[model samples]
Target chain A: MLKSAKRFALTAALALAAGPALGGALGLGSEARPEEVTAWDIDVRPDGQGLPEGGGTVEQGEMLFQERCTACHGEFGEGAGRWPVLAGGYDTLDSDNPVKTIGSYWPHLSTVYDYIRRAMPFGDAQSLTADETYALTAYLLYLNEIVAEDFELTKENFTSIELSNESGFIPDDRPDTPGLSEREPCMTDCKPEVVIRMRARVLDVTPDTEDTSAVTSD
Target chain B: MSTSRKPQGGTTRRGFLSAAGGAALAAGAIRPAVSAGPENLPPNVPGWSRYLGSGVDAYPYGQPSSFESHVVRRNVAWLTASVESSVNFTPLHELDGIITPNGLCFERHHAGIAEVDPSDYRLMINGLVDKPMIFTLDDIKRFPRTNKIFFLECAANSGMEWRGAQLNGCQFTHGMVHCVMYTGVPLKLILEEAGLKTNAKWLMVEGADAAGMNRSVPLDKALDDCMVAFKMNGEALRPEQGYPLRLVVPGWEGNMWIKWLRRIEVGDQPWHTREETSKYTDLLENGKSRRFTWAMDCKSVITSPSPQAPLLHKGHNILSGIAWSGRGTVDRVDVTLDGGRNWRPARIDGPSFDKAVHRFYFEFDWQGESLLLQSRAIDSTGYVQPTKDELRAVRGTNSIYHNNGIQTWHVRGNGEVENVEVS
Candidate 1:
């Protein structure tokens, strides 16, 4: 018990001294080595900044995407079950039920490369090799018809590919939404008649609960 | 009333009458008797007072009363395909005060809860930095720590009510938010330790979950108030809340605060990941999508007198709710009794901290009348929470995110409350 207590005291003392010893400006962590940083730094920017040197054709990407992405992303990136649809919603953004896919709404190709490389194959993340990622990117582009079936994607030419919706997004212009910023608290007779437009219970979307009191009323 | 027989088993006429009365009291039909047999009443010693209670550490960890089991997080099962990647609502109607209890906080997980062992955890800082670094759990603790209360709200909190009044309960419509006091080291200090490069303008923060949830935060926001949090409400974060470590971007949408945080890559531009590009962006009526809409605008909701919690008594009741803003503190909360026909300022209670949930109360004497209940919150920036029609006038119904419109509840003469909309 005495030895353990002494060791605890020594540890505390060293920890207290660490802040000052490392330069007194809250220097606490160790210097990270280059290889360690390389192992985890997997992000790719929109300007093709961090694209790894690799190349793949649409044909190679077709096989890889079909084998690894078909379960959730569907046979043709239409999305099976509740998983995300990855392609083909070109002119649907203005429709009632807009299909937001990679080709339809995404603003950057770097997002595609970064997302698939860092967190794809559903549960098996970071398992895709650099070449496999390049292939999948190629296949998704082809599925969206941004590239020909024989188009080969390399780190050098990746930035040349652009999304159709690249210019579709604008920075947050909230409070710019009409009356969003200029709404004053109404005190009397805000409108002529209050109408009931919709009811969630009629839609029957919410899950049922045991408490009968929680049921929606007409 | 008689002196009574033995306080034990044998019954007289008076004893039988009192027993019947007690039974009625237990059924909630009548007010409890001032004195029940006088043996355990205030004038006499109670049973608990006479005996020794359970010893210390009886529960290594304590829990709320079993009666409070109704106070819990609930999910709309139809919202997702499976519980593993679903969202659960906090029982807001059953909660009090601004700080949501750790267990009852709303939960949103992409790949479900990742059980990360603290000993095996590592937070890597890479990309545009003078010297990239990996921080272990101990290394994180060694940094100067800070404690601040902030609200983490999902961008989809009131998404269901975007078109119109949908969910019947406040717990369902507005329960996708929770406020808690987080303990952690600031991201600025950690970045300073690594020394950011001159051109580092954005950061791609990624988590270690199965989905590897990732988002790009503007460098200004990351350096402003973002934190690498390990604890909430004075305890180690619950497994569902990103145990070991998570990022806390005050006032931003919950998705930007990545859970099970593992990597932060400094870059010159936004990564435009799936979350920021495809999901969180709000599509306008004209087909132009609003991107990088991170901050949660000012919003408020009346918790009680809602569907799940209706008026049980007619007189001297407290109408309570929560108000918050991502931009700053909630300056004022006004309650509307008869829809928007009339409005009254509510009483803001407890600590009013920046970018934190503020509790408010408005007491009213209900005269057994049918009422229309609503609340409007104005943040420190003088931004009034917009009405549903006002919001629809601009963004239209094409979007399902950032719905901070006012919510309405109809209280009937029968004392039952329901979700409703008033023009």
Candidate 2:
């Protein structure tokens, strides 16, 4: 540990000494900057945090979806031409072909709302206003048959909407002793009774030839 | 004209993984060398350094090397329903300098990539919050933000191990992992804006893809350092990389970071959905399931001198590999030639970015002997790399994800390599 500390100290000293020279070489790129590089995350938390004040209705959302989403999602949100079908998929989790969509598979209504507001309208974005976003959320829920066509989704009625898959997710419980109570943790010298090395046959190269066409945009 | 022939117009390429052979290999031999004198060379430019684009050219977006036209993210044609639903690995043997060019990073998905525009993107926060809020992409950018270089590994990274040794090099064994610099607004800031209700303990994040994949994240970790990220390496993310936005969950499995991020519903407990309950979880020998295993434990793999990286230079070869831990930085790495019979410490190179990739090198002289090469990495928390059988003993053969056992490579005097496990 002491030796490591010494090495770290020496490295730090060298960096400090060369800071000016490096800075001089990178003058324009390194100089004068505020913290404002634009995080632009726009992530809204559960408590109504980070939400824009604007609001939209289900009617307005339908119009926006018709203009931008119909090409891929189909007019009724069933999906078109190699795209994933977005509606109807409730309670098909255990089936051979599980239709995992917003109505049947999504665990929370907030997620549906959040996803549409942030990512919907596919290629053309920011064209939907707050009310339009809310309306679109309602339209998606309606298309999934989760809500009635008359259902209104706005800031006022947002919290009441629930998702069918809400109870499917569970919190992480790996490190707890009680969780692993059936499994014993070695106390004394925990040397292995036997050792098996990694054999080359365990490596997989099939992926080297795999085509990555559908990998979603990050 | 043949399908291979083209107009030779400038083809827009993605990531450029300079084949391990090209990493400073010729310095100036294979590729044009840097002339010592300014005018001595006829404006002799290098391979990647040939195209001289200004910083502004890379401002909005940066592409991979022009020479690396073949390197790309590809999915197995037979794996899924269509091209959009399969996955692909990053060109592990083709990369250099640790920072994987974002364009060539590997991708895994149950559904196809979702195309999300940044303009209409919004995040909804509700459930156990005092006041459920909706924020636009603009609002998310307003909070305090931070940056981190981290390796996101799929739990199914070495899932193929469940069957047998099928691949030759580490590129095939563990290419699912990638390390990159992420810039975003911390989840804590967003949660704080929503004002978590006293009972709020977890946040369920969902994606906008047709599959609508969702997972529950613990609120404690969320508030600590989670990020709603929008950019990777210095540019807006690629369309396949959750374009425009994604959740950045450091040190955790890749599944939790929802792409085309849409919502965060705070709640009192985990939702226990199909992904968490049926798919991602591991089923052990016993009937029980190893559910909710979020953290990707410490793992390591020797990247160079493997099957793909044939023994070019006979003597005094420098072996290189990468080791990382979701818990913290890798403290040490050990390399062995005769399996576990003998081991030596490897030199850790470059900065040990927390939860990021760490490079290690070992210089050894060989007289052309047939040998088995293996590397074991120990993290700061003292977790050591396990053996293949050791991991199989506990998890059983019917499992995938989080396979970080010690990897071995067989080397022949003829300079060829093959997959071989030395027990």
Candidate 3:
């Protein structure tokens, strides 16, 4: 009797928690305190808003980049073997397989600033100051030949810098095209292309690695 | 007279390891426990407590036990060109319970894990939004919170199984999946905050990894049941599992969850980024590629009593494994020892949440005979688990993603288990 009563109460609460009866597409729950949790995602738009406040010249950026970034990212912004190439590749997106780089493929310069400030220098992340980030950004632009050797990267001039692939991003407009009518939702009678049966061929039987390096482990 | 064969003729890997040890323990050396009463108590193993470990002060962050040292995501050094291009597997054989400890979650990176700090982070919701808003991690957490356990699987999981039985252990063949509980606010809250314009429909979420992997998620899916998670398993997410923040698209492919999530560009349509164009979409035998594929189908596996993790007890033993669905709750799990011949309804146990892991158990006695073990899942949506042939009938061998079919485990009389394919 007690277990049934408890179940009744729990079920009632769950139904209430699932939100109002009719609207949810998947009956998913919503948040209550939607404002307090700030998602610090430094994603600036093509319009140049949301860029941080900082300034630095290409000359100063050169010194800072050499000291902190050169080892992994090459003397200029040519990146290490495994690390990404940061400078060139201005017009490669049209190729069969483009080698996308900063000045060429990135849609927004703010992303460059945001990325360098967040993660760079390989192991040590978020070590550069805002000023250092701006300088490095300017230096990277110089290497990519986007900015002149003497150009300074200031909050004021940040907007003037335009990326080559700024226009490459096209939003998905599948059935959402202008004249689309109602479509069938994948609730039922869903059709798929392929079906998998038993797993067959095996590739590699996970050979044990020999880590001879006296690498420290966490 | 051995407890080895009640449902009869199945021996475990551990039982095969030390046949002498089983005899020693079964003898008076064991402080046998009865069905009830004081005889059930036994001395605890030294240095180990009844519970694993006491969680520290309010787990603003938490991690797996220090004792679980070997349980980690391991990568095959030669799986790809180099470590950078390779993938890692989560050790599923050693884990129990539905929630995979965060540290053990598998990681697959085209480049490497990008470390993004929360302070300098700012998420811009623009493109087609009426009012573009740049949010901080705090802004995302402030909104109402929800919690649910869901499995995140790399689409490439078990992709190597396309050929023949190459990988010996089930861990390598099936470790690309893990389930964890997330703590965070809903994606709807942020969409509302950014003020989705009337025309705003699709959302393109991008990660901060070196490759900046991006995927176009439809707005309907975003507003319904998606979370921008900051914590996993009661703590800040591990660096490998998208520290700072990540998008939790329940019951969807892992790549769509976008680690180190940096942007949510609301748009009137989808973004045909490099990630969507060149990869993820499966090539069909008919020369077309299956695109915009989302929901992960129902899948189950007999994790134990399989290669790498073999049976031990020669007597009464319990067969346990995980079952789940990306569509809805798992209603039932069926076990087949003779390769789907006489199926038995396995007992479902533990918390039952939609788009989450469900644990199931089957108790039976084993005899010293070779056998085949397999499991099939039935979701709440009435989607019955299909056979490999049935799945292969639709999604041809050319496809690599969404291979949720029955997996078989072959156990030999010697108690050694091998990965098997029962056609």
Candidate 4:
């Protein structure tokens, strides 16, 4: 009993020497202060975690989005010149050309909030305030017809806003890819005859190469 | 030397070429002398051998021979809006062996390359840890280090060919991959140094680029073969690659290997960031999307006899390609000479490391006939590479990522090659 008490006291002394409030063993890194954590911890979860106390209306979002966004994301989030289209494409996931936007494809609204706050305006990132991010989120929802033009988005009501495609995503069930495993590579007579269905030369999309000597094989 | 046979410098050569007899030889209507001059051909010494060559230190850093200028990374102009947010394809056709040269590796940037000063770089380990530590570049180097080789392939390596055969060359089709040796400390060691809390289950790794690109990596993968790599191919990380540091997530998509790595935050649950949700997610034929699909399936492609590197001579052609898998090592790679009609096991050459690119070759004597060529790779897990039809039937044509379907190159009768799809 005396030995066990001495061991506990030794452990307590080592913890004190480490100078860590949480008393971790390695004691390699400096303690992260609250302010430092707040500065870098910008991610937002579906459950409304990591959201700062702020609010913005759809009207405010529309004005801000046009001023900051719309160069690449388009005026109505339709996208311009191969940039990402943020809105529309309500039911095009199953089609040959699925226009994946924040409304038609994204399963969560928190992703929209976190993305706008984290990286937007293309070149300038991390420049959006908490309220501005909320406003942008509101405006994007309004564009997608998820919320009304006058609807306001706040930290308290952020979790209440459920995405239309919330149940559309499934975990990777690959090897669920048909014929992936069952394919037995055949050596001879794999098929009777081979026929070409399409050629890239017909499309003429491939850029011409500078090396013309490739035509001559030694 | 005889006056009649003496070599003239410029005027006589031009006058000779202008003559009818010389014109026929120049036009290939008649045979010309094989050697430029008889003195330089046989017992006499060549110009290079006769003269003293350039001395050492001509170049502080070495480069490929001037004759090899064609082996370079190329970008398709029509693919992206700007070069800043674009990708460059590696010249896979020209490369031999498994190790991709540091300069020739393909580049993919969302917000362009970032030039980071190693002195100012800091990696912070925060959230759900007993101690949230900040590591300087020097501090990171002090830890126990390991050397590993792995292939980093973009999730959208063959996304363009999903609908049909689009790109002509294998470089443009499947050059978004590069395998290299890395020197770094195990990520688990760093995480252990910080001391993870009981609730720590996921990690959010963020980069320092203008995009501030971030992704959620499960702790299971973090504890696996992940590394905080500072050097690639025995040199400091190239600025285009990451510079100071980058996370090396083996067997996962290249994007998840966060470059210019800055922060790693531990948490209980995943943060469904923009990249994981809207972009990298694969849309299935059923209209539902597949999230957190990290691993690249088994894939292979013939680099030679491809559209860019066409068959030149009919005989003694060396057909070569690269094969790899995310789950494990590639056990076998089969080559199809008549499309998928007949398959012959190609000889697997070079190092066959886990999750690294494996080189293979097939030597055949060509008879100058039109040929449809393809290659299929099988990983150690018994998973065979799928055909384009097989992939499209399952995932549909809407996917913009993870298109590892078999690639086909049609070698025409005139020694020309073009990308084609066959049934």
Best by TM-score: 4
Question: Taking the true A–B contacts (Cα pairs closer than 8 Å), what share appears in each candidate?
Answer: 0.51, 0.15, 0.06, 0.64
lDDT of 2 by residue, B1-423 (tens): 111122222333212313332333323223222223343356774444554333353434334443344455545454444555566777676565568888778887656787777787767666666555667777766554567898888888877666567765556668888988888976765666656677778888877676566788988788666898888997787777787789989899998988888767777777655566545766555433466788888888877767666665567888888899898889888888765666778899888987888899999887778767788877776677777677777757655667887777777776666666655
Off-target runs (Cα >4 Å) in candidate 1 are: A1-24, A177-184, A212-218, B1-54
Error of 3 at B63 (Å): 7.6
Candidate 4 residue pairs in backbone clash: none
* Local accuracy of candidate 1 as per-residue lDDT tens digits, B1-423: 111221322365444654565444444323233324577677887654765444567556777643344577889876776687799999899888999999998999988899999999999888788777888999999887889999999999989887777788888999999999999987877887777788889899999898788998998888667999999999999999999999999999999989999988888888888899888999998899999999999999999978888887778889999999999999999998887777889999999999999999999998778788889999888888888887888898978999998898888876788788877
Instruction: Please list the C-alpha lDDT of all candidates, in the order they appear.
Output: 0.83, 0.65, 0.66, 0.84
- Residue runs of model 3 more than 4 Å from their true location after superposition: A1-204, A208-218, B1-68
List TM-score (chain A only) for every prediction.
Answer: 0.83, 0.59, 0.60, 0.84
List TM-score per model, in order: 0.87, 0.63, 0.62, 0.89
Which candidate leads in lDDT? 4
- The residue-by-residue lDDT of candidate 4 on A35-57, one tens digit each, is 77778888888888888899999
TM-score leaderboard ranking: 4, 1, 2, 3
Model 3 chain B: lowest-lDDT 10 consecutive positions: B1-10
After superposition, candidate 4 runs with Cα above 4 Å error: A1-29, A177-183, A212-214, B1-44
* Overall local distance difference test of candidate 1: 0.83
